[model samples]
Every structure is written in C-alpha cells, then in structure tokens.
Target chain A: MEPIIKVENFTFYYPDSQVPALAGINLTVQAGEFLGLTGPTGAGKTTLALALNGIIPNFQGGRMGGRVMVAGLDTAKTPCARLAGVIGSVFQDPEAQLVAEVVEDELAFGLENLAVPREEMRQRIGAALEMVGIASLRHRSLRELSGGQKQKVAIAAAVALRPRVLVLDEPTSELDPRGTLEIVALLQRLNRDYGITILLIEQKISVLAPRVPRLVCLNKGRIVADASPRQILAQEKLTTELGLEVPPVTALFRMLRRAGVYHGDLPLEVDEGQRELGRLLGSRASRA
Target chain B: MPGKSFLHKLNPLTKVVWSLAVITLAFVYQEPLPILSLWASVLAVALIGKVLREILPAIRGLIIFAAIFFLFQVFLIDEGQVVFTLVPGTGIGRITDVGLKACTMLALRMLAMTSTIPVLLATTPPKDMIVAFVEKLKVPYVYALMLVTSLRFIPTLQEELSLVIQAQRAWAYDLEGRNIIKRFLALIPLALPLLLMSVQRARTMAISMETRAFGAGPRTSLHTSTFQLLDIGVISSCLLLTAVLAVVSLR
Candidate 1:
C-alpha cells in the first residue's frame, strides 16, 4: 500500500528565530504503523508533528523546504479543513485543544465541521468516548476534569474523526503516571485492534518505545537514528550520548546478559520480561 | 443532578414566554404594584435558583449604570403634574410625579427585563436550554447546536481568561488593582493572548465536530426536554396575569 504520509527533505524555520526547527528531515508513515518519535525538548518533535497535519505552512508562518504529503494530498495545497479526515492531531496542551464544555460536544466538534450526518456524529462520539473510557464523563464540563481525563477526552475527539493516521504530540507529558498508563493503553488498543496508524511524539521513551516497533530519534532537527527499538537500544553510547535514555527493560536485559545472569533476547514489555524470567527459572529448577 | 430550584423545574421556554408577557404588561400599568410584583417574582426565582449569589458580584457592574439612568431620567422627563421641579421657581427644580413615575417604571422595567435571565442561567444548563429552544421553537438544529457549542465554549474561555489573569497578576501584573482605568488598561494586555488561545480552541473544536459528520442531516436528540404539566400551568397563569391586566386597563 502507498504510504499515508511522506516527508521529503522537510525543513522549517520559525519567523522569530534564525535557526531552523526541522532540518532536511525525510520520513514515511504508512497505514497501520505505530511509529514513536523520541527526542529531548526543543528538538523539533512538535514541529514534525505539525507538518503531518498541514499546520506548519498554513497556521504557523515558517520557512519550508521540500515537500510533505498527507494521504496523497500535498500539505502545501490542501486546506487545513480538507486534511481533517486524513490526519487527526492532538496537541501537547489539553486545555488548548478543548473547545466545548461538555465531553459529548467536544467529541462532536470535528464531526460537525466535516458536516457528518447528525446520527453518525452521535454514534462516533459515543464510540470514541467508549474507546477512551470516558463515556461516564459525557455530561461533565471539560474544566472539571483532571489533566489525564482531559487528555483522554482530547484523544477521543481526535479518534472521532476516524482519520487514517493519528498524531499525538507529547499527549501524556502533562499527566501523571496513572494517566500516562491509561493513555498508553488506549493508544495501544487503537493501534493494535482498530488498525489505525499512530505517530506518537514523546520524550519519555521508556513508556512508549516498548509498545511501538519503529523508533525515530531526532537531534538538532535531524533524524539521527531511524531503526527498530532493538537496534536503537543496543547503541547505549549513542542513546545516552545523544541525551536520550534507553528503555529500562532493554537496559536491564543488557546489564543482566553482560553479568551472565541469564538472557536469550531483550524483552520490550513487562510480559515479555516475565516470560523470559519464567523460562530461566524453569531451566534452573530442572537442572537442580 | 437535576437542579433544585422552583424555577428550575419550570421549563425554560415557559419562563421565557411568561417573562416576555410580564415585560409587555409592565409597559401598560401606571401602578408600581405590578412592576414590583414582576421584580419580586424574578428575585424569588433568582433566590430559589441560587442565582442571587452570582447577581451580587456580576451586577456590581450594573449599579453605576442604574445610578446614571436614575439621574438622567430624574431630570429629563417632563410629563404630567409636577412635584419637585428641577429649575424650581425658574421652572426646573423639584422632581415631578411624572418624572418619578417614569423613573420608577424605567428602573423596574430594566430590573424585570434581567430578572428572568438570572433564573434562566441559575437553573437551566445552557446545553439543555439550547436543545429545548430548538425542539420547542422549531429552530434549525444546526444553528441551535452551534449556539449550544458557543455557550459551552463561553465558560471554558471565561475560566481560561480568569486563570491567565490570575497567573499574570500572581506574577505581579497587578490584575487586582482597583483603579477603573488601570484595570481597563490591564485588560488590553491580556486580550490578545486570550483571543489567540480561544481561536486555536475554536479551530480544534470545529475539526472535532466535523469529522463525525455532525451536520449532514436532521439528527435525533439524545436529549429530550419537554414541558411538564407544571410548566404549562405556569405559562397559562402568566398568560392569565397579562390578560387580566389588559382587561383592567381597558376598563
């Protein structure tokens, strides 16, 4: 299948700054792919997220180089409204992304803009709310929510659009650990079950990189590492050297294997770690 | 939770229609009793709805306006028998009965005009009211939904602005300053950021609303707001009140 989004030599410079936010970056996001973007703050993670939705050239006045196409439509040519169905974007700040007071209405906002049939809109709102585990908050005001609940509602709003690719820009950074887990679980469900592509931009790779297979590391607005998590995590010097932290389990597995504790392969998730540990313990028991 | 208020149980459409009737009748009566009655009813509603708490602070703004209005009418109106002429022996001294009458009517009319609003705001959720308005009055659903969304966004923006103001003042922007002009000038410093932020919110909401196919056609109401028997009885009694007054006036 054709790539849903293609970025070729994309560079961006803010109006006030002399330096570019993104420097000649090239990337491709295909349908149904869960891609994790990792970098430190001010590393153009958000700038890259904006380019996928045509917000860079249209909303933010900035210097642009090369081409960014979303769902075969040129980001340069397609209006922001036109990109609604193709790219769903959630911002870093939940408050900035919220428009309606009520949860149901917030979910209905983008559907209303697309002029969807009213019943379908309601259905999508209901489905999205259910998907995000926020159906119980339908009547509550947006301001009444905790930061995590609000982010869930924000994600629900994006999912209601039913876009092929969903881009979340540090959606959980402002949230607590519990909130982070809730959002990551929901995102995993979306990517795994619904077959929706997800482009997640976040700094806390320990939380996200394990779930997504692909990882893109950025430094000074350039893609310094474009590889799977297993490959990327092996280069400990490159990771910490570039100010990025490797996932805890990956680091733990590397440490255990180095010390000859017992390891066949590096496990990414907790379950994977549990299974590996269970096998090692079983082998020791049998030998004894 | 359903709001606990006498007026809260009454339909918003009933309040709107009845208050409109009261407003129309307020114009015809020469007696202060009916005008006072209208004011009293509004206050009762406001009190029952717990809107009185909000009225105090929000209407600190309307006090100066009321005073200015009191002064303007106290001098400008020159009708009927004179009591205290504005000039005195020069022909404009003591206030006239007509002036006082006019002033009483004007003040009471203004008060009564806003009376229902507090009750409306205090008891009815803006979303429920908008849905009711659309369902009851045959307003196009899209427009009503837009209006509902706008009202929904209103409180969000207000809260955000108040927060921004407080945060700025906490950082020594002096938003708590009492000077009228300085406070007014202080608003200028905050307006741009608020507008920019609000616009961004609106754009996001618009997208969120559209992607679900929100306005493709006539949609079913997840909310059903119907007038209860009490609402009907209330509206009927208000209609009777207006009719009785009109009859009394004709006689």
Candidate 2:
C-alpha cells in the first residue's frame, strides 16, 4: 500500500537564517498510522508539520530543497488552501487559531471555507461536534469554554473538513494534564476508528509513548531516530543525547535490566512494565 | 450580556446608526442645546438599557479630556471680545467671550457626541460588533473574522506585554522613575519584544487560517445576522430625526 505522506531529502532554510530549519530529512507515514514527533524547542518539528500541508514553501516562503507529497499531491506545488482537504492542521495555541466567537461557528468555519452546501455543512458540523464529544457546547461562546473544550472545538473545526490526515503541532502544550489526556485519547480514537492518519508533535513522552506505535525523533533539524516507541525509548544514550525524556516506566525497566535483576525487552507503557515486573518476580520466587 | 431593554432589542447596526446620528448632529450646529439634548437622549437609552453604570467609566475619562480641551479653547484661541485676564501680562493672559462660548459648544458637543460610543460598547459585545460589521456594514467575512481575532488578542497581548516588562525589570532595566520622553524611550525595549511576539502570533494565526481553508470557498456563518422589526424602526427613526434636525439647523 502507498504511504499517505512521503518526505524525501527535504531541506528547508528560513529567510535570512544561516541554519536550515529542516535538513535532508526523510520520512513516511502510512494511512491511518499514529506517528508521534518529539524533540526539544527549535528542533524543526513545527517546520516539518507546516511542510506536510504545503504551508512551508507555499504560504511561508523559504529556501527549500527536495519534495513532500501528501495524499498523492506534491506539497510544493499545491497551495495550502487546496491541501486543506487532504491535511487538517491543529496548531499549538488554541486561542491563536480560533477566529469565531461561538463554538458551533468555529466548527462551521472550515466547512464554509470549503463551500460545502448549507445542508451538508450542518451535518458535518453536527458530526464533528458529536465526534469530539462537545455537542452540548455548540451554541456556547468560545470565551466561556475551558482550555480542553476550546482545543476540542479547534479539533472539531479542523475535522469538519474531513481531511485525509491530521497534523497537530504541540496541541496540548498549553493544556493541563487532564486536558492533555483528553486530546491524546481523542487522537487515538480518530486514528483507530476513523482511520485518519495522525502526525502528532508532543513533548509528553509518557502520554505519547503508550499510545503512538511509532515515534520519530528529530535533532538539530534532522530525523535522528525513527522506530517503535519501545525501540526509541530503549536507546538511553540516544534519547538523553537528543534531550528527550524516556517514559518513567521505560526508564525503570531499563534500570532493572542494567542492574541484572530483569532480563526482558523495554516496555514503553506502564501496564506493560507492570506485567513484565510481575512475571520477573514470579519466576524469581519460583526459582528461590 | 446586555439586558433586554428596548435599545438592547435593536440590532447592533441600529445602535451604530444612532451613534452616527448623535455625532453628526453634534457637529451640525454650533449651539449647545441640540448637542446636549442629543447627549441626554443617549444617556436615556443607556439608562433604559441598564448600561449607565458600565458607560460611566468611559464617560469619566472623556470628561477629563473635554475639560482640558475646554481650557485650551477658552484661554488660547482669542477669537472674540476679551472677558477676563487672570495672568495680566503674558501671551496666555486674555480670555474672550467668543472663546468661552466656542469652548463650551465644542466641549459639550464632544462630550455628548463621544458618549454614544460608551453606550454602544456597553450595550454591544465585540462579537455583536463584528456581526454588525459583517451583516450590516457588508465587510467581507474573513475581514470580519480578523477584526474579532484582533479584539480577542488585545487582552492577551496586554498580558504578554506586562510579562515582558516584568522580565525586563528583573534584568535591572530601569523602566520607572523617568520623564515622559524617557518613559517612552524605556518602552522601546518592551516594544521590540512585543512586536516580535505579535508578528509571531499573526504568522501562526495566518498559517492556522490557511490550514483550515479560511478563504477556500464561499463562506457561511452559523448565526445569520438578520435585522428585526425593532431594528428597522429604530434605524428609520434615527435617520429621520437626524435629517429633520439637520434641515432645521440649516434653516
């Protein structure tokens, strides 16, 4: 099967900046895959996200090399508006992204821009709100919403366009832990049930490692690591060198293995770690 | 939220028209009677709308500004017969009857005419103001959205600016204890970072707008702004009264 997104030797430099924001980067995302992207600040995560939807070379003018293709269309050639149907981008700051006053109006904004028929727009808005679990907030003012609700509304606004892929750039950076969980869970649901390809840039390793099967790590505008979350977290030296925190569960497992107490592969999630620990102790007790 | 007073029931555009009527009528005649009467009518609307309390704060500031303007006109202009000379010898000594009359007319017109703004603001939310711009003023929907977004960012930018100022103060930058020029000069450090942040915000918002297909096709709003019968009545009466008053003043 063809990948939903493909970036080949992609290198980009901002205007008047010496260092390239993204340098010789190669990446691929399959349809319906949940890919987590993480790196320190100014690590080119946002630049890469913008490139996926053609905002880089199209909307934001910069020196660029190589190509990025989304949904069979080259991002360099396609205008950001045309790519809107193929890629829905949820930005970091929910407040900055919201242009409407009311929740329902925010949802309708994208569909209206896409010129969907009035009847169709209403259905899509309803479906998007229901899917985001914010149907009751449809008529409420955006000002009165909690941070999580506002982010949900932002997600609804993007999803209303029914894009093929969703790109979120640090969506939960401004949200609380519970709000972060709601968004992560929402992304999981979108990936699992709707089969929408999700590219999430998140810093919360514990939250991201458990959910996203694949994690891509960027460093200094380069894709230094691309593997399963388990594999990525197991490389203690690489993760530390790149300034990424391994999930606490994964770190504990690694420490146990290093101390010669446990002999098993590193688990990226808490439940998996718990199971591993239980089995290790049970076997040890049996031998004793 | 505005109370369900008769004025509140009128569309925001009707209120805007009423404001324009007051401003125009205030400038149309040199006499203070018409302007004061117009100002009283606006006050009555504010009172009935239960927004008098909200509007008073803005009116208070306007009164101070008007007072300073009145003083300038009465002392500086020297357009009519001399009335009083408190200072006796210098260029700023004389006060004239015509200057006093002009100052009173100008200040009262300014005070009364400008007071309508506070009334409108007290009665209309920013969202309704954008709605009025979109539906009544025929501004493009995207531009209307920009207006709303800008209004939303004002408080956010203010907060961010304060943080920036505080951060600078922590670095031992003397932002206080300065003359007017020096204080403004001290703000340069604040302004640079603020401008950069504002630009960043604008850029992010623009990118977000594009990703969501902001201008991809014909747009439709969830809440359609339609004028009520009350809006129509208010608008017509306001225009008729203004026109009649204009003709009378001209005569």
Candidate 3:
C-alpha cells in the first residue's frame, strides 16, 4: 500500500520567533490508518499539521527544509488550492472557518470553491452533513450553535469536498466534554467506516490513546518517539516529563500490571479495562 | 393575500435597477417632483412588503441632513426675497429663490437616495443577493463566498462591541455628570477592543477560506437561486421606464 503522506525533515518558524518551532522530522502515513499526533504545548504538533496542508510553505512563508508528499504530489510544489482536494484541514477554531449564516451554505462553500456542479454538491453536502450527524441543522445559523456543533459543521464542510485525508488541529480544544466525545466519535466513524485516513494533533491522551493505531510523540520540535499507541502509553516517565497527560485508563492499567493483578495484554480503553477486571474476578470466584 | 406588498414580490435585481435609476436621476434633474415621487414609490414598496419599519432609521438620518442643508442655503446664500436681515451684507442672512432651488436639490436628492433602502435591502436576503451575483453575472464564486462570510460576521462583531460597551459602563458608577466628549472618551477602550478582535478574526477567516477548497481558478458555485418570471419582467420594465423618464427629462 502506498503511503498517502511522506514528511521528511519538516521545520517552521513564525515571523518574530527566535527559534524554529519544528526541526528535522521524518514520518509517513499509509492509507486507511488512524495516525495520532500528540505532544506537549509548543511541541510543534500543530505546526506539523499546518505543514502537511501546505499552509506553512505557501501561506506562512517560513524557511522550509524538507519535502511533504500528499496523495503523490509534493506539497512544496503544489499550491494550496490544488493540495486542498487531497488534504482537508479543520482549524482548532470552528468560528474561523464558518463563512455563511446557514449550515447548508457553509457546507456548500468548500464545494463551491472546488467548482463542483450544483446538483452533485447538493447530494455531497447532504451526505457529509449526515456523516457528521448534523443534517437537522442544515438551516441553522452559525451564531445559534454551541461550540461543538459549530466544529462538527466545520468538519462536515471539510469532508464535503471529498478529500482523501482529513487533518484536524486540536479540533476539540474549544469543546466541552460531551462535545469532545461527539466529535471524536464522528472522526472514529470516518476512519473505521469510510476508510478515510486521519491525522489529528491533540494534547489530551484520552483523546488519542485508544483510537489511533500509531502515535508520534514530539518535544521541542523533535520526534522523541514513534510507535503503537499502547507502547507510547507505556512510556509514562518520558510523557510526564514532557508535561503531557496520560489517559486515566492507561495509567490504571500501568499500576495494575506493576501490582501483578493484570498480566495479559494491556487494555487502552475503558471497556477493555472493565472486561479485564471481570475476567480476573471471575477466575478468582471459580477458584474460591 | 390582500395585504401582500409589491416590494416583497419584486425581484431583488429589479429593486436594485430601479434604485440606481432614481439615484442617477438625482444628478441630472434640477426639479424636486421626480425625486419626491421616487421617494413616495420607495415608501409605498416598503409599506407593501411590511419593510417600512426597517427603513425608519435611514429616513431619520436623511430628514435631519436635509433640514440642515435647507437652513444653510436659506441663511447663507443671497437669493430671492430677503426673508431676514441679520447684520446685513457680509452676506450673513438672505433667502433667495435660487438658494431655495439649491436647498431643494440637496434635501430632495438626499431623501430620494435613502427613500429606496427598503426596496433593495429589506426585501431580499443578503445571502441570496450574493448567490445571484455569482449565478447571474458570473462574478467569481469566491467573491460571492467572501461577501456572504463578511455579512455573516457583521452581527457577531456588533454584538461583541455591544458587550464591550456595556462592560465598560458597568465599571463606572457615576450616571449623569459627564460631558459629551467625556462620554465619547469612555468609548475609546471599547472601540480598541473591537478593532483588535476584528483584526484577529480577519486573519483566521483568510486561512479558513483557503483550507476549504477556495481555489484561485474559475469554479462553479453550489448555490442555486433561479430567476423567476416576475424577476425578469420586473427588471426589464424598470429599465424601460427609466429610459423613458430620462428622455422626457432631457426634452
């Protein structure tokens, strides 16, 4: 399977910043895989996501050193408009992306820009709205929505363009707990059911710990570790030193393993933790 | 329905076309009657659509401005019967017929222009206008997209500014002792916050537009607003009437 995006030594800097935000990073994301990008604040995760979408070289104008290939085209060579078809980016702030009063107009915006025909856009916009589970809000204005609903509408607009991969930069940072779960659940559905590739930058470990198959940890613009989500969670000392949160379930499992109460494969999610406990208690009950 | 207004039924394009015609007439014709009638027609349309309430503020601004102009012309310019003499001719006070004509032109033209705001703005949704601009004139879809986005945010920024002003007022305990300038000075902090927030929003909006597939090239729009038969007929008839009015005024 061909990798959808290949990043080699990507780095970026804002206009007045003394030091580069990111430096010398290499990574590749294959098709149909959920890739988790996690790091402490200022770890260059968001900057890396921006680089993936061609915002860095084209819009920001930093001294870029490496190549980023998305859907077989070099991001450096490709203009923002063309790269947009293959990589859909959702900014952390949904308020920034909403351009129209009505939800239908917002969804149609991306498609209109793509110059998709009117008939097809109607169908695609309808489908995308349904995918994010906000079809009922097709006529609601941006001002009337909660933050989470706004973000979902933003995501629906991104997905409506039919991009091969979706990139979100701390998408749930503005949402409440319930909103966060709703957005995460939608993303999971897109990955699992639609087979669209996903790249998300988040600081919350509970957000990425159980969902993504692969994780890349960054610190001070460098990739310190890249491995399976379970393996990355096991590196508690390193993660804590970097000021990142370890998910509650992952931490619980880590303690249980140390105490010899859990010996089988470590579970990353809450349901798995409950099942493991039930199995252990069941065995004990039988023995007694 | 018997109460349905004509302005509500008029196409947005027709409203714009007629408004432009009357605005153009303001510059050419020296007489006030045409403009007066134009004002009446606009008001009648607003009344029909129940959009009369929407145009009250603009009408208020125009009336105040016209009064100022009439007063200035009557007092300053020396024309017709000298209605009053105050400290005589450093040309301080005089009301001439020519001066009256000038005042009429200024006042009536101001009224003529504002008189149509309800017709163009209140009768149609701003989003549909933008969509029409794209679908009909083939103005690039991006321009229409931008127009709608900015329109969407107008109320948000207005509400934000309102809150800022209220917050500033709450901090001050005194109610009525300050002079007007002092009251105005208090607004500086509020205005600065609005300016700062708007700049931030602009930068973010620019980035957001790009990420959503707004390309530099020509593209079709997803919005679909069609011209009704009434739209076409209304616009054409307005154009013809304007042409006739121009010819008659010239003769």
The numbered model that scores best in DockQ is 2
- Chain B, per-candidate TM-score: 0.80, 0.90, 0.81
Q: Candidate 2 residues A146-198, lDDT tens each?
A: 88888999888889989989999999999999999999999899888899999
Ten consecutive residues with minimal summed lDDT in candidate 2 chain B?
Answer: B217-226
Best candidate according to TM-score: 2
Q: What is the TM-score of each candidate against the true structure?
A: 0.75, 0.93, 0.85
The C-alpha stretches of model 2 lying farther than 4 A from their native spots are: B79-81, B88-92, B141-143, B248-251
Correct interface contacts retained, every candidate: 0.23, 0.75, 0.72
Ranking by TM-score: 2, 3, 1
Task: Encode model 1's per-residue lDDT on B1-251: one tens digit a residue.
Answer: 25576677777798788778867777776677777787777777677666787776545545566667877878777677777754657775557788887787787777666666655666777767767887888888778767766766666678878888887877888765789988889888689888888787777655444433344454455456788999889889888978998888757
Q: For each candidate, C-alpha RMSD in Å?
A: 5.6, 2.4, 4.1
**B1-251, model 3: which lDDT tens digit per residue?**
11256666555566778788778777767688877887777677677778778778877887898898788766667656665566677555656677777788788888887678655776777777786776767776567666766777888888888788777779983334469877677667878989898888887777777787666576666655676788788778877877887888889
Which candidate's lDDT is highest? Answer: 2
lDDT scores in order? 0.78, 0.87, 0.80
DockQ of 3: 0.58
> B215, model 1: CA deviation in Å?
9.0
Better of 2 and 3 by DockQ: 2
